[model samples]
Target: MLKGNREQELIELAQKMIQAKSYSGEEKQAAETIGEFCKANGFDDVIYDRYGNVIGIIKGNRPGPKVLFDGHIDTVPVSDESKWTQKPFAGEIVDGKLYGRGTSDMKGAVSAFTAAAKYFAEDTNRDFAGEILIAGVVHEECFEGIAAREISKNFKPDYVIIGEASQLNVKIGQRGRGEIVVETFGKPAHSANPEKGINAVYKMSKVINAIRDLVPTEHPVLGKGILELTDIKSAPYPGASVVPEYCRATYDRRLLVGETKESVIAPIRELLDKLMAEDSELKAKVSYAVGEEMCYTGNKIEGERFFPGWLYDQDEAWVQAVVKELNNAGFNPEITQYNFCTNGSHYAGEAGIKTLGIGPSRENLAHTVDEYIEIEQLTKVCECYYGVMKALLV
Candidate 1:
């Protein structure tokens, strides 16, 4: 259980994080604060990766499996401050809730694991085995698994715990997210003589209709792999008396297990090919969207938007071990899965490591007007993380 002073420390750490306001690609202040906390605590060493990820290493006296507590430090921007009852960056505590921008989305989880690692290391005095690595990952809001690739390469942890919002439920899997781009091409001509030009918008319409007809794949547990048209734009903003010659559309794809990049676009490409065969003038292309962002450390991080989905059977040994310990610790966490994508997409979906997401708040609270996390949830999750370490760091 979390004690009074430890709980107070955890609350203060989360407050400082909320006050820092670290948006995507701008997490230096929050990162520095986390690093300072790790150093002031019992962490043996703290290092910033090339991408400005703050990693705190607490090694036990004996060697065993490496357990990583992963949480992203960046957050979505607060679009309107006036609409929020609580200031987004103030980190105010009201009626047992700590209000701020990144509290629920994830700075609260980061602070939990940070304080948990400190308490665990001090309580054991490094008498246990294995390693406890608490990482403050960056750029997760922009690229789900890109920076995590760096962390995996650096630590090669035996297991990963993603501190995504799970409302204290034990998440075993998720339907990953992918951004698919489709474009159409045609010849431009004067609107006065529209028949002389092939309107790209018309060409794109055919593709959109075909996509609408495509069936979404289904999973027994993770639900269907749904695809929806999100954005579409033509080359010319204002027709300008000319027929538009190019159209681009982006689709949000919810990925399921066993779906790959080639598999995802294959059906769309087949439809495009069939359309092209019927009409020789029709031209288009489809591919995954590539994302590139500048990190706060002045480093560049980029990746394809095809974050893979993953799942684990509830009967897996580690899964049961964690459930047993958390249950024994007075946390009745249900064995479940996240409804949205998370950093687990990289660790479990891409890197093929066993992963679990167990965090402190509701997912819907993220990116809202007045985002906040309960102090009770924060302290409970700190104890929960410690329980995970005790269960796995054998």
Candidate 2:
């Protein structure tokens, strides 16, 4: 376990991260802080990817499996700052917990992984054959796996360990997610005569009702897929007296294994097609939503909203190795799964790489107001990460 000064240093690093408001598109300061910490702790190589992901490498004398410890630097914006009893960025400690934004969601785990790397780097007796990479990625809050996908193009790894909150348990996989937009088109006319124009909003209500009745596929491990209508809007806002020409409904769909972009979208498309065929005046279209954005480093990324789900078999060697390490560390290791998504969508889901997740905080506290992580759990995570690296590489 990390003790004394090392433990204190981990806490301080976590505090520093909490102080930086690296929300989604604005992760520059957090990336720099993590990068600087890596350099100061004797990392063999430190680099910032074109998209501003901070990567720290510790090369070994002999070659073995390439292992990556992944964590995102970006966090969801604090929704209601007034609801927070403590200063969100102060990293205040109360009852042995560090409270702040990104503390439980991720910053704490990032600091723990960095501390683990430092311990390994400073150990004279440490001998390993492989590469250890710690990546502090951006854009995970807004775009689930795009940044990690960018990082993978440069540094592909044999195994990926995500540091998202897992309550110190090991997570095998998560349900995939995708965004879909259902749009209804109609003729615009002055609101004075309702019969003169087809009302798109009126047509869209039928589509929304159909979607609400959609029964999702199910998986034994990942559980049932879910569909939630997150947003709905009509064009020509603040109109004095005009029929809206278009109406759009956005949905967040959780996918299970064997569910693809085509499968997830097929039902909605069919519903729209049927509705349009039934009424000549009603026209509607369904398609996956696409996100196009520029990163903090001025890198452009564009992709469909689908973030695929994945499950790593518990019997896999790398998984068993991690579980063994956790068990040896004096903790009862339990195999769990994340209810939300992470960078695993890129690594394990899309790239088909072996991946697992283990970290320091409860999964439920990720984006809530006044987030916090246990100080003792942080140290334990550090030790387990270091131990797992040694076991896997040596």
lDDT of 1: 0.92
Off by over 4 Å in 2: 124-126
Q: lDDT values of the candidates?
A: 0.92, 0.88
On TM-score, the candidate that comes out on top is 1
**What value does the lDDT take at residue 336 in candidate 2?**
78
Worst ten-residue run, lDDT, model 1?
A: 1-10
* Model 2 lDDT per residue over 112-199, tens place: 9988987886783446788899999988887889989978889889889999988788899999899999999988899999789888
CA shift of 227, model 2, Å: 1.4
- Itemize residue pairs with steric clashes in candidate 2: none
lDDT score, candidate 2, position 180: 92
